[model samples]
Target chain A: MKKHHLRIPGPTEVPEQVLRAMQAPMINHRGEEFTSLFKKVSEEIKEVFQTKNDVLVFPSAGTGAMEAAIANLFSPGDLIVSFSCGVFGDRFADIAEAFGARVERIKVEWGRPVTYEIVRERISKDTKKEIKGVLFTHNETSTGVLNDIKSLREAVGDHPALVIVDAISSLGAVELNTDEWQIDVVVAGSQKALMIPPGLGLVSVSERAWKAVEDSKMPKYYWNFKNAKKSLEKGETPYTPAVSLVYALEESLKQIFDEGLENIIMRHKLLAKALREGLKNLGFRLFAQDSWASPTVTAVDISDFQGKINFSKALKNRFNITVAGGQEKLKGKIIRIGHVGYVDELDIINVLSAIEMILADEELFGKGVKAAEKVFNEGVEV
Target chain B: MKKHHLRIPGPTEVPEQVLRAMQAPMINHRGEEFTSLFKKVSEEIKEVFQTKNDVLVFPSAGTGAMEAAIANLFSPGDLIVSFSCGVFGDRFADIAEAFGARVERIKVEWGRPVTYEIVRERISKDTKKEIKGVLFTHNETSTGVLNDIKSLREAVGDHPALVIVDAISSLGAVELNTDEWQIDVVVAGSQKALMIPPGLGLVSVSERAWKAVEDSKMPKYYWNFKNAKKSLEKGETPYTPAVSLVYALEESLKQIFDEGLENIIMRHKLLAKALREGLKNLGFRLFAQDSWASPTVTAVDISDFQGKINFSKALKNRFNITVAGGQEKLKGKIIRIGHVGYVDELDIINVLSAIEMILADEELFGKGVKAAEKVFNEGVEV
Candidate 1:
């Protein structure tokens, strides 16, 4: 009875209730029942986003949402500021560039967050106000770094540049006040902290972003924000949506609401703390700086280990545990352990023990477990 | 014990086996297991497409695939001929126009298929041969009309126009030989005849379309076929896929293959015949002409009925049966009964009886049942 434990940064474990909810029979997307379901789900999603802005749902992965943001809010030759600290941040910039945006990318080190000082400096230097938008990632999944969105928005101060955030791996697990931070657009995916499968891409649009959409001349049909908004007014999508995922999202949202959003965020923070302490005790170096480490995923440096590639394979083969390896330039140098949706302390403990067992080192295993327990015992007071 | 019947044109009845398959635990999409699954599903999809060309799967609705075809296969200001007979057909043209294509629309009356003569006339008139592609729908779900692709392709004889088809609701339930018909691109969705929920958009691109892609200047990121094809060669998708839907698709494909493609098409034909006969006996007229009526969805004229709005409401409220109504200009004038996906003869009989009951006419019910039974008794033989 060996159960596989999934600890990927995204596509984390989904609860059985959510899976069962998705198993329900199909419903007509254009019908009364589905309209009500659609409305309810939209409302719930907005609640999670902590915004009164329109939340548009698309039958796509997070990258699609990122593209939608660029295509809908900017026209050809529009200048934009894109901050890149990791792979996902770079991807956000790439989407903008693909749509003909002249992007001035602010590159930061892989394991560091995009500092507010750099953002302030960039926006201040743009006295001409040629930049139409600022594209950044709330949480860099590849590096497990979380940028300070509120501080970045504050730095943009009174500027017309829309703040478009890729909150794919962070939204539900972290404290993101969309409206308070004045983010023009926030792009997210279902397979991350939402505790659902990959298919649906959720985006929250502010009135300012809607204005940008109106003036935008970028060629788009499927990802057109106006069509989505119009259909959403009628409680339907412009195109057919991924119905099963919506059902699963309903169940997942129910679980989220029951636990409360604030508590969920706190739980994630505590879990990350425990996992980081465990890794530290096991003599593993943390990938990201402590100040901006993402609560959703923890990256541990494995470059010093002799069998880096073999380590992930042995963990899966021996204990049926799945963790993610570093992507791009950091490949084979780090392992990412996701503590996102549907994950709890027991799951974390199981993963820690499995890693220790794979190492076959008693002293490290004892110290790691003790460190994790100390963190867990303190409890998530928030 | 009231089991609701889903008879909409899409979001059709999914099989229990497929639903169960979707309930499986999440697997790493970038891992060996998912790579194997992805390859197997791609090959099976090609079998259903009836083509040796590449079949690209996107985690989006059918409209996304339509957008993909336009974005990848044509540059801005590229001349294209789009034949519009119904809502979906017009939508195809809209996508092309949105991408800056100068489309020559061959508009036919609603509920009628675009004839080969009209296509030939349009193509022959373009003596300059400036038209890069000819876009048409295989099955227009809005009006229950199925155009003749083979005839249309033959009409474009020695021309350089690429034959792009929207086969969202007809591919599996109709006889469409992609290679034999020389189709350049075919776009389809999962929820119609594919017996799955709404999420995946499957597009098959011939060698000709690939050439068009190389020269296309339209900007694309999310729906870029080149990136998708590149990743597919490595047994992966450029972006994360809706993994659960792929699992469900595998199960759905097994059911399709087990029953046989030819037999499935025959079943749809026979079921459609039964449904049309039943509607006819009940003093109703078919919306589409009999010669080119779609076998997947049967549209019945409801303009003369005083209780047009109440009809669908009564069907759902009283019988728990869901069917589709017409769109655009035909709304509240026609009701569409979908026999696509997992629907059978018994399901059709139940719907017919429910319609009769809603009318409160015993004589109509008896005649309808008899007409349906006569066709069902004949049995489908491929």
Candidate 2:
């Protein structure tokens, strides 16, 4: 049997146990068994999200949760300050715009993170806090830039505006202290770092978010926060959820907790470091600088070889390693390698080894995999 | 080994093949494998939807698809006539109202079907054709009433109002010719007669509906029809879909085709008829009259044993047979026995015997199971 691996940012490699979890028979969503399972999963999800507030799960993509945050926190014409580094950040801001919000974006170069200096400079202008909310992409998977949401929170500095973070590709892989950072809402997807499929969208709401939700005048039914919260109290969802995916989440959370959150985060960091160093050793430049590079995914700049070589496609055809090509303006300029949920040190080495084989450059190819292995040897237990 | 069965109306029992299908490892959503799979699924879905139009699949419950119909078809403050007979019907209207539609509900008794007479009577009064859309629940799972959409279509003859139907529970179980009925949009769920788990929400859109979509001024992002349509051309979703559920759909659609659509519809009818007759013979009254009784689920009037003896809970506790209790005002008044999606005559007989055992009344106990068997024996195949 041929083996295939997903090295894309989301819908990462589901473990054998987690995949088996999806094979479990369907259960009643409103019944005792599912109620208990949901309650358990809901509680466990918070540990990974690092939130004190309840995480409301929906049966849509991370984008749905992003839309939910926009629709629930503010009304039309609400002023929102969007700090966008790359594609996902732009999408979050775009969602706010689509919902009729007047978004003033603090745009940065694609390969750079949205620093707190720019945030403070803009937020300080809002004396009355006319900006009702702020949107930030914690991890811009497209450009491998991970903005520091904790620092951004401090930049807001007791401003009444809600701080919403799109942690779709970063949550669980990295630390996102929702309550500690005073982040009003954090939207996440099941597929990214949760080791589940792409159906379930999780959103953690703090006390501040609930207050904003009450004042929101937006019209919503399916993604309505009040209905989701009301049902979460009963250990149920307002509508039928992805029951099988929830089962998978239960199993994946068990693996995550077994590995320990701190260990998992460290593992991600080590793997990303190894991959990045290995890529650089192979004569590849990274899109984001080391200071802002994402732990879950790495964007390898291929601008030098854009028309001359096809990096991601070569890996896909030769080794069955599915990596993502760039999007929008970054298209054909960079190749993204995902090392998120269920990926280990060996996975990084294998991908690096494959890249080396694909390139077949005598001087550069042999050095990359060895460099990745060295990182694994120097790091903690793989 | 405990075998728990789901006999709910929405999240019906998934087949073994479909459950196993969910075990397949995650793949990249934007990859070629997924593109081909999506393309094949998109084509196969139309056969069941009975339309030439593209069926947009969302990673949410059927309620989300219902909301998508409301959000994508008509703008805010548009006049809509919602013919509501049950909770879901009322919910469709509520979603329209939540989206700022001027909804005028033609309400009927909970157990009664929304007849053509009621639709025509209301439609004729709107001579100016101010009614932008008409919302109908083809099969009200809450009351086990199946309204005749073809008749309703005739009643709205020559009217420009878009006819939207919530066929979540009835689409695959019963016969629905989307093109023949000229239904502008029909929302369906995966867990029903598709024999998949509760995740995917599918909607078939007509060309007329696309024109309305072009003119729709409603602010939407996740459920935006234009984005979905554009992506459909590329055999991809605008966002990450429930990949496992889509895999399950492929397997389940194969099952659907192998059994043949007409045979599947007949089987659902046979199973429902036997369950209904068995329950009737056991001294249980039906909620919906025989004239408009649904062929997917049967509602047994349990008001007689509401407080005295819990029917659905007793079935669950003693037999591990999960059935649905009534919702909203009908709570504790009826018990719904779902016979759609992977259910056969044997399932009906087994559930009937369990109900008889739970009743334990000498006059009503033995006859129910035997009556179910007679229906099965007279039927062509289980």
Candidate 3:
């Protein structure tokens, strides 16, 4: 079978080791073996999230984690400031709204990051401090923008509002100091930079978030944080967990720790830098602002291309490379190339070469490849 | 490494083919290949469910699907009747109550099944007919009892209360005609008889359930049936699905269909029968009623055995055989041997032999093995 490059923002390429780990025989979820495995994975996940707080793993997708954050921490009609810069950011707001939280969205333009100024203005404007929480997406997958979570948290200083973040596509590939940044709740998925399949939703909750959970009256059973915490104490989940995915996660976590978290984040940064430069050399305008460009995914403006959908289709059908199209309003106007999880510099090169072949632009291809090489040669530390 | 028998009710032993299927490389969830695979698997799942209605798959454990059923079909304060027979049944009621639904429970004895008489009397006595839905467990894993869902549905007699069943531990290993029985919604888990790991929650929604969903006011976003239905139109899930689990499900469904659903259910029946007879020969009484005993798991009373916990632990530690101990009220009183999902007569023999060895009774071991052999040789058709 022809190899297909999966370049979606999340559900990034899973490594062979991780896939093999998933093939391990199923074990009894409530047994000692599983309990140990669950505990180990939970601890490893907490380390990755850079938090000393409790981390809950659910057998669900990232959106479910997003929902859990809202459902577990906020009651109906509770006010929250949602910083929406992209689709995923908007989804956080949507989930809060769906659960009856009154979401006051600080809607940034598409392809822009949630700036500290916007967060400060939103929180400070709430003089009565009616807002019970602040929701932000650390890495906006759709627009390929990484928000300054630390700055956002600082902006909310002593406001008594819980700070919740969607770090689905960023946790493993980007720098997220959950504890240092005072993030009350941080949500992530196994499918992204964790290099596993889409099944597990990982969330870390601070003492402050626990307090909110105590006061929260949102109707929740499946996503109950308290129940998950109780089960976690026993080294088990409240319900049946995705055993295979947990196995995959264990292997991936081992690999990540072996490689070191700092190295993984650096690798993502270097590869993302090269990818952005390569795309620019190939006559594509970068969608996200340079300073806040995400190291996980890079959005490119393909509006100049005739039939952007056809271009994306050709990239997949003809070249065996799958990339993401713009979601919602940005559909057909941009294409996204993900460089998270198991991806490396060579993978970026192959994607660029495939795009070159599809566009039949040999001259642009050479320039793009050279630009990427130059960036790699510069030693990638910055 | 010594192979271990995973005898849990839901996450029973997965077949090698299914495990290998899960090792397949990741693909784009929104792409054509995934769409085709999604459609094919969805159809096969419906076929297994014996339903003409829409079956939605969630990246969650069965409890998530149970929550979806309550959160989607019933609004806050909506009256529902929950027939509690065992732990899983109680959980369904708890989920409904958690979501703010008023659950009028028909609480039966732990090992007793929800009989048609109980359901009939409950519904008939409610002259006001305020209950909007009836929740029942087709197979209660905790107590190893199989409720009479068909008779219960008949007892409802067009009361406008939607009949929802939890078939998590019984879906594939037992016979369930969703359409014929007119179940409004049926929830299942992949880890059970589907022969996959625990992650995907499959739910079949009848047309009547759709009407209830439309009028329901409970908060939901990630588990929204309407969004899931919309995505199903495009042969996708509303949120990212557990892709590897879906691949495993595809293989498992193929194996199930190839074996024929009737033969599969018969295999479970035969194994369950052998296990029960074997346990009885060893001087253990069956916990569940003979007529309502589940074919998936057999609950054996171990009150005669001192240190039941040590006996169970020895079975696992010494013989590499794992069986579920009684949960909640039944703790230390019974041990459950799962004969569902990829289990056969030999597996039953192995478990019985292990138990006999743990008990250190030669006479009991000989009698148990003989009883199992006799049942197997009798052709198991009955």
Q: Model 2, A12-61: lDDT tens per residue?
A: 88876887889799998999999899989999999988887889999999
DockQ metric for all predictions: 0.01, 0.01, 0.01
Candidate 1 regions with alpha-carbon error over 4 angstroms: A1-382
The candidate 3 chain B region of ten consecutive residues with least summed lDDT is: B361-370
lDDT for position A226 in model 2: 94
Where does candidate 3 stray beyond 4 Å? A1-382
Winner on lDDT between 2 and 3 is 2
**TM-score, cand. 1:** 0.52
DockQ of candidate 3 relative to the true structure:
0.01
Give the C-alpha miss distance for residue B298 in model 3, angstroms. Answer: 0.9
> Candidate 2 versus the native: TM-score?
0.51
Superposed by TM-score, candidate 2 places the C-alpha of residue B365 at a distance from the truth, in angstroms, of: 3.5
TM-score (0 to 1) for chain A, all models? 0.98, 0.98, 0.98
Q: Is the docking of candidate 3 incorrect, acceptable, medium or high quality?
A: incorrect
Interface RMSD of each: 28.4, 28.1, 28.2
- Candidate 1 chain B lowest-lDDT run of ten: B361-370
All predictions: root-mean-square deviation over Cα? 26.1, 26.1, 26.2
